[model samples]
Target: MSVAAPPPSETTIADSAQNPSMNDLVTEQLVSSGDAASFAPRTALALLHYDVASTILTDLTPNELLNFALTCRSICNVVIPRYIWAHIALTPKHPRLQVITLLRKIAFSVECGPHFIRHLEVASIHVKKPYLKCRNPWYLPYLFQELFTQMQNLRSLSIIHCDKMLPHLPRIPKAIVSLPHLRSLHLANFSYLALNLLDKLSGLQTISLASPTYNVHEFLSSTTSALQKILVNSRHTLEEIRLFEVCLNVDLIPSHHGSRADADTNQELCWPHVHTLELPQCIGDGWAPALHIAFPSVRTFASPEQSHWWTAALRDASFLTGLESLHTKSSVARGFTMAGYTTRRLVIGDDMPFDVTNTPLKDLLPRHLVNLQVSLWSSYFDPTLERFTTVLPMVTPHLKYFFMRMNRGFICNTYHNQLCDIVDDIRTLPLEYLCITWDVNCGKKRCDRCVRRSCPEPVAKYVERRLPSLQALTIRVDENRRWHWKKKKVEEDGVPAGTLSLMSPTREGDILREEYAKRIV
Candidate 1:
């Protein structure tokens, strides 16, 4: 029997080796198959337990990071500790109950509630109802106190109160007064209670008070001592203060004759480190001297387009010595010559009419200006290329950035002619960047022609040919409500190569291509 079995040929053995049993095939498939749970452990996710993985996770969006953590238990352990819930914004558009419930859910996490939140903004929509008021003022203060109590790392807080609810809200709670890390506070349409909160926050570096409900003079009168205390405590840390539409009363400061008491009192209230002061139009002449005395180190001042504050500052040579930036209208710029003002940056509003013939751009701008922005309503009477040519030589020594915005209606052929001439003159300046935007309504009758002519190719070519120091140029033309924009970068050889272009109503690309071909021909 053994000899007969050994007689099995090589073919028979080979056939047996080529074929496998059904149980063996099923076992092999079971061993190789993997689900989400098995795949996650075998991938790079196992490395998440290391510190290096947290750095990569920090770049992911909040929702994306949360979804990733939900994939498996191992990933959740590593992601939860690395996630930072830094910014939280709540608006009235969201259901009140839903927002509150979500906030409560976040606060329930003991480890994240206090350590993660950094910036919090709460804004309510402005609703004008005849007889129904949905806002409960009592609920707002309680909610603020509860949230502030839980968020220990909050640095910036913005609260926009409803106009109808401002008068009924309670005083700022003690919870807000004791935040050690809070540096910025923005309060819009707030009541007198905000002053109490402000008094205790001496470590704040940036404070913006906008559209206060109470009279400015009365509010300052009640908190003069507290204000003095804050100045003494935060003088070194406070850098920026913005007051929008809130009047400043000079009478709040105790003025003494040239006696030791005056020196001692001034020393206690001086803000020696404040560099930026944004004033409202309500600030009067009396407030100017007080501001000069209080904030002697201020170098940048931002005011309304027509406020007389800049005029008052201009008269004080001592105050104007350190002034570096002026944000005002062109009308205001016209009254003051550039001879004495040391301002290096000027931002002019578009509402004013700048007559190049009358004002002469050379005289309107300071010699030391490094940045100039002229936002004007250009028309037939706007500045000409000759005026720019004349002025460029005078200011080119220091001017590095120029932004010109022309907002007009019905831009005719003359406008483009003037634009080409201006480009010819721009080639001579050592500008670092130039941005020109034309916002106009090209009638349907001329959209096709205007779109072709407004290619900005001529301007780009001019810059490439003449301007050697120019780095970047941006030109935007809006025709019949459609936007067309192009940006170019000047290479080391001084030729501007097209970097980016966007044309709406996508079919315009074909028209632009045809225009380019014709120009080449």
Candidate 2:
């Protein structure tokens, strides 16, 4: 006798109801009966077992069950082109609701779904339809309206790339409009002349508009709504009232907002309540004046090509007051370290033009800086030893973690001493983590002068000194060797080439730990 498999959840009733052989019979019966959900659960479970045993599998895996449910309908209209639309043998009416229920259950689980929700969950469901890669161009509008209406708990709604017609006269369902959970609303690529649902959301906190043809006054006048933040991605017109939008003028021409052209002929623009701002590469010198004013209470700011932007933005007493963290694409932190400014953190990398040589450690650092991560590829690698020396005097007081890479550029040279000085100065501070990497691509003889040979000594000394506050020291070294028998035998023949002597010092982890134990003890 054979054993029977248990049934799937109620959400996937069809999967539990019909077999491939019985699809025609089931559909025929469902068509005749006029209702699929009203079918007996026992009948459904029997069909599912028959199909599982006869065709699909002897036993279903977790992925198979979830995929089966997803195909039944969670993300709809996601039909693959030029491929077969394989049916699940059971066709039920309102399959979408069942899929939604299954997804909701999965979302409530302790592990993955809940984790994704916690990270992605926000006050609203901001769907950038315009950014969505069109799966099927034919049913775009209908599919969008269906998905938008289904999100019953959505609060702040941001739907980008919605056609103007949809935005101009959004035909939102009565159920969606009445959702007490609904709050702020943002629309882009939606060219609606008027939105009737604007005032319905009484708990709106932020409203952002990013349409090519935006009428600021028209949007504001349309609703007598109260909001804490408003962002308009357009130079349509500026009201003397508070506004939040960072502008980048590629041609160095300030926006023409019709009010007082002659009031301040100096063209010194200023933003008031913007707490976070991003100045792209296109912005120029005219931005300096704006930075002095808008950055009073700014907490996080980023600028890619504009090194001067950081200098100008930080010089303001007000800008440095409430500042907590700063991010730049380029290494503007090369010459400077964040030691003096009140900001606590710094992130500099590829997105910005990181030129640390120009922005010395003194000018870049704020007073209370606690954590900083400079990009590994920044020019600082070659000149890091010197830069570290200059930065140590100021950063050592508050620096907690110094992360770096020991690649080709970082060799046993003058920079080695600078690293020692930095470690010595930071020994007294609560520096807890030091993550360093060394690339040992070639055998010791092939690239004997590689940087790895130089690092162990300093690392040994630092470890022997015993950084009491340090908790974890992770070092990843890549040993790469290219066969150079020709060079090894003929080139250095007189020097007794082809010898199997180890050029790079390899220290055992146990030895390092023992050394550490002695120093700490």
Which candidate has the highest TM-score of all? 1
List CA RMSD, all candidates: 15.6, 16.0
- Candidate 1 per-residue lDDT over residues 1-521, each given as its tens digit: 00011112322221222212223322332343333454445235534334344455666654444334433323333343333342343332346454443333233222233222222321111111211133553444455445546655557767676333333343333545666777786766755654545565678788766676766566454555333344456667888877776545431233321224467766666677788877644444434444566778888777554455555556666656777776666656655556455577777764533334555765567776777777655455445333544555566467767777677634544445666666666666666666666664555575554633455565565664565665555565653333333344444234346543344454454354334222200
Q: Which model scores highest in lDDT?
A: 1
TM-score of 2: 0.44
- Give candidate 1 misplaced runs (Cα > 4 Å): 1-86, 91-147, 162-173, 217-233, 250-261, 280-282, 290-292, 303-312, 331-339, 381-390, 409-420, 445-466, 474-521
Q: List TM-scores for all candidates, in order.
A: 0.65, 0.44
lDDT of 2 by residue, 1-521 (tens): 11223333443434432223324333543554465664454233434433343234323433333333223322111111001112111112354443333223222221222212222222344443331223443344344444345446665565555454344324453444565665455655433332333333334333444432433345544542122112222111222121223234321223332134564532333334445554444334435544434334456665546566556545555655565655665345543344344556665554222233554555555445566555343334443344443454464467665545544433334444535654664566665555444444444464544555433444533543556556445444544321110112333525344322122223333343223322211
Clash-forming residue pairs, model 1: none
Off by over 4 Å in 2: 1-68, 71-140, 156-274, 280-285, 289-296, 307-315, 329-340, 349-360, 376-394, 401-429, 433-521
Report the Cα lDDT for residue 364, model 2. Answer: 54
